[model samples]
Target: MSGTLEEIAGSDHAALARWVEAAERPAIVRGIAADWPAVAAARAGDEAIAAYLSARDNGNPLTVLVGPPETGGRYFYTDDMRGVNFRSEKMPMAALVERLLALRGAADAPSLYAGSTPTPESVASFATENPLPVDTGVDPRIWVGNASRIAPHYDMAANIAVVVAGRRRFTLFPPAQIANLYVGPVERTIAGQPTSMVDPDHPDHARYPLYAEAERHKLVADLAPGDAIYMPPMWWHHVRSDGALNVLVNYWFGQRQDRFPFAALMLAMHSIRELPDSERGAWRTWFDHYVFGDGAVHAVDHLPPHAQGVLGPPSPQRDRMVIDYVVGFCRSGGSG
Candidate 1:
């Protein structure tokens, strides 16, 4: 087993708390299982599973599960399901299923949502369920796979992921651990499979000496079908499949979209307000040096301007705040 894995599986929440306090980063809580039945329901059918497998087999955009009708409700299988609740633009499952089957039948046929081409039904059906007590606009993504892999990347919103069919290995390190993680170019990352800076084992200790000291605060939970993991904001995690088939659903929540413009303004104004052009470029270099590296996954906001690391390291308060921020974001839905 890897040294990082050893630290993760053996450690308790108290140890995690200590790391959080010292590092001012995200923490992981293991073995919290919920809503397995619904996850299985989506993954049950051969057609659905085949469709998903075909998507991945051919390098297509995987299916996404939008929000449910109720708060924390079971995830709806189709994108159009949200149309009934909110005025969403979406491609109905019936049509989407046809698209999937069509692609399977005729490999020459173009894939759905392929390019700049507009999806009129999907665009028209974009909507969200509102008037709920909790912020519930953000649609979550659910996937079922037989030996599938997700490339490393940081999401703009906080994520709560649940495993339903099999096991998975999550290699996580705090954002501060970026220097140690050998990262790749950002342009390559946007396409998918963003990676680390340093080699996990044979790191170039001379170039990134500080990376040696980066604590790999990791946790490897052999999540049974129902278990879930909550990856807090700004945290970096890479996942690998460990079972015959791994089924997972992830919820990403953040404050309203309206606030993002404000957040971006705040970030731009505060971080680089006074730097000259040369210095500004230097700042980007600084960011590229410390936060993003060759093949590494990272958050742009977590860099200098938007916010510094978690206020006081990882504390109960900071954890709560991160959760609130994510859920809040979800409440603010988008047009599609």
Candidate 2:
């Protein structure tokens, strides 16, 4: 109710780039993949889509996630959160299609989800025919399945997902809702990332009362063939594909970075969280000044660019020094 996904024309590359650079919210690029051969073929029928992909299949066995209908087409953790509900196995493209066709009309059919698989690997010419005008040389990945759903999860990289066949609904939330989403164990993550334990379709308010707060910050997008959605880095999103056959082609580009942010965060966690409450409060002030203040006193006006090193203009030696320090830290059992 509060936020909505704004739609923009797919041909507007300039607008797309602007949105990609500063998309404080999700945006929809309608008919972005309309010219894609696979998407066009899908318009004929599911068999057409299957045939096209099958013809292009390079005979490589790929990972396919399988789950029973009792899990309601969702690939997630068990009730006790010990392990994932679904299991995956390697299967060739043609065999996977045959199995999906056999179970197509069955009411009690098990779910089959082939996730974030490479488009070019499955169909060697896919990237050439369906190229997106985003960053150069960034190939697309395909997610094909039969009426399956993936739980809400955040990706570390920025994402643009194009629907090729069938329809998809994305229930999205901002990263700030991480606390309200009731996330499960990180180490036990099933779907490449730590996904929300609470099912958005049938959320148990009694068990997850905070989810209502997250919902207040939610935005939704329904994608048709050729439609695409742009999601910024670390934005939480839940995706559900409808109908018999669904295929989503997505591209992920790493966020721009020039320094060792992850290493610094790890160092901070190692040193900061164990401090006493009073000392921890002091650390917050210190972080606000040093880390969050865009390298404040240590930058620009006070120090020359050469002296500023990693905090100011880029320095190759400083970068190498930081990398070497991290490598040494790792090799020496994290000792100072």
Candidate 3:
């Protein structure tokens, strides 16, 4: 059943890290960044926060997506799904903030969003001034916008998102709800990841009947300026940013897979999806035994260690061999 997210206090960094690592579901951390300068600035007013960020601007132009008011701040595909509804503009962080502030009270202001901009590149001192409690190897990225809705999409790695300014609402669904979400095209997507066609805010139940099933498993979280949320890998989430100006800082970690799973899925679809039912079923069994199933560890135990190759174990040598084989196969036009 759908429910509100569990709340946790981010007082202890070690405890917070442990909890985040073991969490199977998403959790909202209350006032985790209350002491941050950005949050303080946001509390003062939208103009204060804008000035704070602009002061740290590195002068690099960030690509901002601009969507007309007709889309109602929801950036997505056009009617025919041939192209996106938003046009991208490269502008400095200060300029973008000024534009958003100017249209603050407008009833039909165009959606302006600058997503996944590297904090160090755009705002030179942002990372240093507002450091995350725990280290996430990769640098944090900033998402700045004004009153926008992003479709439900899953990330490949685990994420910790902190709301530095304004407010955010996250509607989350577990990975198992994939089938019911009515996912769009994988290759041609609004963003890099394939997003759900059904809008969580206003689901078209008639066109998407199965979304009702997905709605049953939904979990919602409303985050304020200093609040934070932790999401595990592949948890589908639809995000809505409220207020005239919003800023979110997020860190993505635990993405060191040998090969991207989505790329493997695309390759399998090309090679195996159109096969005969019997053949496909047999391949499924093989995949289960060697990939998804627990018995994969011992699947090649019967063979000599020297001859086991990629099936034997996860070692540097085996990983290199697998990579070489894949590269060779692709280079040979998949003849092998």
Candidate 4:
């Protein structure tokens, strides 16, 4: 794949600028230029190498990315990951091999991997081993596999993903940047992880007119090892592993003081949106007076109140509750 930050010129830049402003999406810088060494070291060993090979051969949906030639050309395509089951299972070499062989010639069995990250199996195991925290964070975990494609999805909150081995391609659009990006049907059971109906090259404009708008604001990044990508809340991104053994550790972060816009939206949804329409008027007034305020009245002025009562106390209980709710929402198919 092309190296990170493939900036388009002239009209492309103008179109991108409009899209960025319209969508308020996050920014991305490619060729971080510093994360390569660690990425190389991590993939150099036998155990790690074996883990990757096993995932690849068994149809586990993981992928790997090697560096570009110093002279520079597209990175090599290390594997094909179109159909591996990343959502349901990840197992030993033998089991994966068995499953792949069983499906061979039986039907349209595309010998590749495709599915969500933190598959159902992984989530279930995580929930039991380490209860998700409320208003806080989950226990840190590292995910390594091959050819897995995290379909078009938006993550709640903020996240930083570090590439340990291999390369990845990420296509991102802002949450508010909705015109050209097709949002998937929201599941009643799960929430937060919204699906994007975007397919970079040939997007369906008739069905999803907004996607055309989202497309105008598109940004693409091809990532390499040691490289970490930060996805701000509400931004939509579709990830495809561009290498053989792609190992990544994701850090899901909490809302920070600076991320008040997201926090305000979250707060408004939980507090005011729950109120009856007539009653909600008062909250809007408050929001206008406090959040969008007179030239000088900013959101921080209202934070003290939230810190005291409106949002309840700042403790692990609330954090855990939020985590559990979100996790459950995902498990139940919020992004289905």
TM-score of 2: 0.91
**Candidate 3, 272-314: lDDT as tens digits:** 9999999999999999999998998889989999989878788
Q: How should the candidates be ordered by lDDT, best one leading?
A: 3, 2, 4, 1
Model 3, total clashes: 0
- The C-alpha stretches of model 4 lying farther than 4 A from their native spots are 1-38, 41-48, 51-87, 90-140, 188-192, 256-283, 290-336
Candidate lDDT values, in order:
0.44, 0.84, 0.92, 0.48
Which 10 residues in a row give candidate 4 its minimum summed lDDT? 68-77
lDDT of 3: 0.92
lDDT of 4 by residue, 109-159 (tens): 333332234523332232233232122254433454444455467766666
Please give the range of 10 consecutive residues that has the lowest summed lDDT in model 3. Answer: 10-19
Better of 1 and 4 by TM-score: 4
Q: Estimate each model's TM-score.
A: 0.44, 0.91, 0.97, 0.51
lDDT tens digits, residue span 141-252, model 1: 5444333333344555566565655576666666666665656554333233345544333447887676555534544444555455555555666666543334565566
**Residue 136 error for model 4, in Å?**
13
- Please list all clashing residue pairs in model 3, or write none if there are none: none
Question: Which one wins by lDDT: 2 or 3?
Answer: 3
lDDT of 4: 0.48
Best by lDDT: 3
